[model samples]
Target: MARRIKVLQLHPDYNIKAHDFADLGEQIFRALPPARFETVNAFLRGRPTGDQPESRAERSIYFEFSDAQLKGMRIRAMWQLFRYCRSQRFDVVICNRFKPVNMMLMLNRWLKIPLCIGIAHGFGEYDRAYRRQQTARLVSPAWRFVGVSPAVRQYLLDCRCGFTERNTVAITNAIDIVQAEGLQLSRDEARSQLGLEPHVRLVGALGRLVPVKGHIHLIRAFAQIAGAHPDAQLAIIGAGREHDRLLREVELLGLQGRVHLLGFRENALRYVRAFDIWAMPSLAEGLGLALLEGMSGRLPVIASDVPAMLPLIQGAGGIAVAPADVEGLSRALDEYLSLSDEQLQMKGEQSYRYLTERHDIEVFRQQYLELIDSALSEVTL
Candidate 1:
């Protein structure tokens, strides 16, 4: 009997909830042919405090670390990962983000893992020179780099990190439409659940409340036209360090009741139906996964005009405003508000159609499996 290909997916974070990396891991594990492959997940940090979601992977291992240990995390994590990798003897090591790629490369140098694959999820992951240099060191024929978007792939190439066309490929991110559809709530139901008024038009955004997410700009934009559209409300979901700052901003803008800060919802996408339109004003994004989820929920999108977002929103029943341009976002919101209910519904339908036709999760899964297969087939033990 043939042995199943043992694969280890290395993630930098301990928690596996809400984040895109967790979603990607789940999709890959669920889609892979179980008979031909066996998968395990190894996270570098200790388990998070929140309720852990049930994982689809065969097994999961966490390297529990203390706060003091995290101060010099790279060295500690590398030592722990080295011990783990030596014991597991995985045939393929898939590293998410640059740090994990570096860790895997360091291990590969000693262990010579048959196949090592790195995934670039966003622009910020490789923004630093140290990360680029580390990536350059991992550019052997046995290593393959997967970028979550073409923009990211191009960025890798432009960095001159020894990533050639043969070693790097772009695969757009995807959402689990089946699970998302199941979680869908009726507009009225969702609004009621969130304590929102039935008559109000809600503009929704979902992401970590971090600076790069540009929630501040979105708030500023909402403030610009809040008086003109008294029936409109802005709902920002997810929690981060910017939570208190954003609350202060909302109060300062005198948008106390109008802007709702719904923090870190486990099933945030379930409330998408409550939104009249989806707004993503991120300053930088690999690809707007929230925008995709909104589109899947049949909501028209309004996002920043960054390269990562443009490909998803342009000509896809959505509008793009320049990043940090409060006036532009205000105008876009006002225009969307002005549309008739029928027009808005038509736009929503178009978004759903576009998402279904192009960004289906099955397509993403198949592409990923193909990449994995290519890597395995090309490299010999």
Candidate 2:
């Protein structure tokens, strides 16, 4: 019998509630081939707050460290990772963040693992000079750096950030179409459940209430056009530190009734049908998975024209506005509101077609498998 490949996936955290990193990790975990691979998921931090639901895939190994230990957590995590690798003898170490990449590289100096893959989920991962320097120092021919978007891959090369053209590759983020479809709720029913009037034209945005998400800008933009379109309402979902501040802004703008701040719903994507249009005004984004989820629901999108988002929205029946520009966002919202019902339906159809053609989870899983296979072949040769 052929030897089964042993794989280990490293992550900073595995909070299922959070989007982006955790979502990507979960998708990969579910897609990894069980027949030919033995996989284990490991995290540097302990279990997240709130209920920790059991995952369907392999059980995770968390390296619980206290606050003081966290000060030098990277080093401690590195030592723990090295020990684990040594005992388990994993054929491939997939590092989900730069810190883990650094750790594996340092370990490779002695152990020489068969394959090492680093995944860059967003542009911010390598923004600092020290990070770039570390990447430059640790990068090797044996290692492959995967970017979640073309813009991200190009940014790494253009910025002269440690990653070379030969070593870097882009793989667009994807959504589980089946799961998203399953979560779908009819527009009227969804609106009714959320206490929103079915007659009102709703604009929806879902993400954490963090500053970088640009929720404040979205609210400001809605404030500019609320009076002009009194029938239109804005719904911002998800919870974070910015919740109270957002409430204050809503009150200040006298939009208490028009703008609804629906804090963190477990199945927020199901409410997509309630929205006439989806809005994402993030100041910075990796690939805007929420935008993809919105598209899956066949809703026209209005997103910031950042590098990470531009390619995803362009020519997909969506409009792109300058990040943090309230005026631009308001205008886009107004334009969408002006369109006839038929035009809106056509645009939504276009978005659905684009999503089905380009961002399927099956394609993402295959790409990852191919990359792994290619790396293994190189080592064998």
Candidate 3:
């Protein structure tokens, strides 16, 4: 019989933000072979009152701070992580972000199990200058560090860690594309369900409405598009602080009727199909899953020519415009609208083709399993 691999996933539930860990955790669970693994989770509830997370399902491990104090919470979290590690005998620990993981790494060095993996959800190159890894107190004891994008791994490689390209791998985020793609409903069908008219052209974006996401730039671009197409509308499907503020901008732009803010939807995946065009004008992104989700549903995408999309789109599929360039985005949208069904289909097909080759669900699942399997190979851990 094969040895069983015990895995513990850590998540900090704060405010209303459904961080990327939610998707990453669920996908990994779905990918792993149930018979070969046992799974658990540790959620940090440090902040007493901000906004509660949506819904949750319990697992083998649970730790909650249930109070508010930054320093105290960090200390309690570090303690709880060690206790969790010692208690569960986890063969592998997958840490979502840096903070708690780094803390755990330093604490675990004494009786290290040797299979610690840092699955980075945030891309570092977008922000601060690279930090000193050796001096950084919380570097994971993890054999491999998984970056959601090649850009992230390259950023680390440029940082000059001791291992010469031996420790990092770019595992692009994956969705259950088998269940998602090709089941696309007709635009008319989707519009009818969305209470939209046949003649109205809908441009949509999906993600948390935040400044970093650059949804505001997209709104600006859409305002320019709406200036001409009286019936054109923009629908944003996620909720955040920027929600009310963005709506205010729409009203100020005299687009109260044109821009629709559909706060977080239960079936947001379904909404991606309804869009005539999908826009991702983010200033920074680890990897644009929404872009792949939109493309899988056959929508022509117009993304910012940033690292995430530039590497994937390669100037094809739909349009790649300069970041914050509202005129460029508007022009791309116009060009897409001018294309005939066949021409549009050709662009949409490029998206589908790229996804099939690069972001297939199986590719992601296999890579994840292989990494965990290798990490847990030697130890009785």
Candidate 4:
């Protein structure tokens, strides 16, 4: 039998746990049949802390580089990685995000790896002129580009960076629905755990407390309808620098008791069932995995009109408002609040159906398998 095709999955950090956002590395590794592929995972920055889970690759390596070391020229890091790659004779390298992709581009010119695939998560990754120039100059026939969403793939094609239709494609992000559902708490249990009354009409969001998440806008929109629906409450999960600022916005709107910022709940997806409605007012997103998590919980959804989110909202029959448009968001929230229990449940079922149809994890895994097989075939030819 021929030797198994050696594969390396490179990541900038180890922050993404096994259950998060389809667990790309784990999915890709599992997609390749074990008898045909020998898979390894590498982290350029962080190491696992405490009970932090890792990718399910056959082997794992961590560089443990400092922030400063990963910056500037990254010559030292490149030398070490080159030696490692050379020693292993990897047949394929899959780099996540810009930093790993950028480094691999330069190193591969010398290593001459038969297949190098770079995955871009969102727009603006190549916004810098230098990064664009470097990518355009170093890209070769051996390389392939994957954007996490169709819009992001188009963004790559328009960047003037050597990514072409032939070399670039989209593989929309997905979540492990079965795993997420199994981990979720029941509605009443989730509500009680979140310190919410079981009977309250809850609007929920899961994301970092960052400006791009548009939590401020969501807060303002909820404030617009707060008085009308006194029984309704808004809860945002996750933590970030915008914590204090968002709190101030809540106070300014005098929505202290009605609006909550539950900073960074671990396995926060477990609490998704507590929400009567799910809102994603993001200004930008690769594919809004959190929105999928909420849909997996069978919650009625509403999101901004941003390209990344619009398709999901429309597919699920959820409302779509202009990003940062408080009036529009408030109106959408009001409509959901006005719906009777049966109507809300129907909307939620629609959302869940759309998720399974369009963003199923099995489809995602199959696509990756096909893409990899096709890429490997080209290498042999």
Candidate 5:
């Protein structure tokens, strides 16, 4: 077998154990044979916190360092990598995301022969501009870049960030559905496991509880639905600073009993199938991976009318409402709540059909493989 390229994936922290959208670099790199990508986590004041992973991937490592610590052992980690690159043995170096791109770029002066590539998963045009300008200064010596969405790719291209359109490809967000076998559990079974009543209409949202997720809007919309359907309950998975604020809003709206906050379920997709309606009202996203997972679980979604969600909702699978419009969101939920079980199943099936055809794991894997293969050829030149 041929030797595989070596990659280094960087991230700040593993939020809710998602390994972050930034960690998509390592996920794709792991799929390539004999190729090893180690995860390097940069914590603010100390080591990153979380339970250690039980997965088969032993190559992953998280480093917590202060400015003082960055000078000691962390310096050695970079020096060691530099020396390894100088051996002229590895095929390439993939520097994942851009938090410390400048440091990586500055230190690659030690690289003897291997090429450097970047994986950028920016969400919006403004953010892309802000990040790329910062990245150019630190300049990790990456010869190519990959993004997860066309919107992201366009953002880079518009800025003329020194990457040719051909060199900046779209690989998209992906997950291994097979790993979560019980993730596709039947609605009744999942509801039973969670002790959910059979009669309650559940409108569910999943993702980190960040402001960008627009959970506040979902809560506002659900408050209206709760007004109409007292038997309806809004359930959200994922935890963050926004939790208490969201709960406070629920109470202020007098929806403490009607709205249930289920924080960060490990099997998010499994719990999704139990939902009467899956809602994604994100203000922005590179692409909604959680929404993809929700669709795969046969859940009909009512999402925001952003570039990323338009394709998913335009098909028969779900509804798309104006962003940040509570009334529109409430109206969509009200209509969904009135749907018969058979009608809901049909919409869910439609979502499944569209997602399987356009956004399945195999499609994502091949796209990633092709990106790497093409980048290797360019780097060889």
Candidate 6:
């Protein structure tokens, strides 16, 4: 048999749970057939803490760099990473996020890896002049840049930072519908665990409580309709610095009891079944994974009218309201609250159908496999 192609998958940091970030790194490793590929996963800034599940790659390495070390020039980290790559003679390096991608681009000038693929998760990665100029200067034929969403790909193209039609592509993120559904608790159990009454109509959101997530807008929107829909309640799941301010907002709106801030639930996907309707009022997203997770639970969705989420919301037959527009969000909530039980269930079925048909995990895996094959084939030619 020919020698197995050695691949290195680099991520900036390790997640607390194996399930976060949609397990994309492991999914990529599994895409390459074991007989033909040897995979290694490297975390640039985190080390395993007792009993935490690690990457599923054949091997895993943690550099354990600090925040200050990773910032600025990152010369020391780059030198260490370069030495590691050279010693291992990796045939392909897949860099996830900006820091890993930037460092590899500079190092590959000497390391000369056969193939280097860089993935960008969201916007504004190359917004700074120096970042763009340096990227344009160092990019080579061996490098391929992937945007996690079509909108992100367009952002890269518009930046004119050496990412062109030939070197850039978009691969929309995906989730395993079956796996996600299997993880979900039954509606009654989920509600009970979440301290939600079974009879209450619930509007739910799952994300960090950051301004970019637009949670405040959702809270204000729900407040608008609270008096009209006495049976409906709003619940947001996740934690962030905005917790105290958001709690104050809740109090100011006189929605203290009606709105629930379910902070940072582990395996939040399991509780999605507790929602009557799922809402993601994010001001921006690189393909809202939470919205897809909600769909996997067969919940009807309401999402902001942003590029990353518009197609998913429209395809799923869900409502789309303008980002940060409390009035519009309020109207959208009222529309869902008015629906009959049969109508609501049908809406949810549409979301599930859209997810299974459009964002299937199998399709995502095949796309990555094909992209890798194409890159390797180009090298041979």
In the range 117-203, model 1's lDDT, one tens digit per residue, is: 889888766668886787688667778888888998988878887788888999888887777888879999999888888988899
- Window of ten residues with lowest summed lDDT in model 6: 15-24
> Which tens-of-lDDT digit does each residue in 1-381 have in candidate 5?
544455444444433243322235445545665443332222223332456442223354445434564453366656654554455344555555554444456566555334556666675432556555755554433466777777676666666656566567766676655543344667788778766777788888889988988989989988777767877888888999899999899889988767778787765666767787889999887777888777777779899878766776786358999888899999999998988889888888888777667765666767766666666666552
lDDT for each residue of candidate 6 in 172-286, tens digit (9 for 90 to 100): 8888777787788999999999999899889999999999999999999999999999999999999999899899999999998899999999889999999989999999988
Q: After superposition, how far is residue 247 of candidate 6 from its true place, in Å?
A: 0.4
Model 5: lDDT equals: 0.66
RMSD, every candidate, angstroms: 2.2, 2.3, 4.1, 1.2, 4.2, 1.2
lDDT of 2 by residue, 1-381 (tens): 777788888876655543322267777766677888878888776665566553444656777755465455466756777787898888888888666776787788766788888888777667788877777776776788888999888877875756887778888889888778777799998898888989998999999999999999999999999988989999988999999999999999999899999998877888889888999999998788999988988989999999988977885769999999999999999999888788888888899899989998888878888888887888952
RMSD of 5: 4.2
Error of 5 at 361 (Å): 1.3
What is the per-residue lDDT of model 4 for residues 1-381, given as tens digits with 9 covering 90 to 100?
A: 988889999999976574755677787776789998899999998898888887788888999988888999987898999999999999999999999999999999989889999999988999999889999999999999999888889999999889999999999988889998999999999988989888889999999988899999999999999999999999999999999999999899899999988888878988999999999999998888888888999999999888777889899999999989999999999999999999999999999999999998888889888888798899862
In model 1, pairs of residues that clash are 238-264
Per-model tally of clashing residue pairs: 1, 0, 2, 1, 3, 0
Off by over 4 Å in 6: none
Give the per-residue lDDT digits (tens) of candidate 3, residues 1-381: 877677777666532234332277667766677788777666666333445354232363445565452253466666767776887787777777765455556666753756877766656622343434541444544557778888767766666652236667889886667677544567788777667666777788899888887888878877787766776788888989998789888888888778888888765776666777788888877788888888787777888888767877673456888888888888987787677668777777788778778787777878899888776665545
For candidate 3, give the lDDT: 0.70
Instruction: Pull out the clashing pairs in model 6.
Output: none
| Least accurate 10 contiguous residues by lDDT in model 4 | 15-24
- Candidate ranking under TM-score, highest first, comes to 6, 4, 1, 2, 3, 5
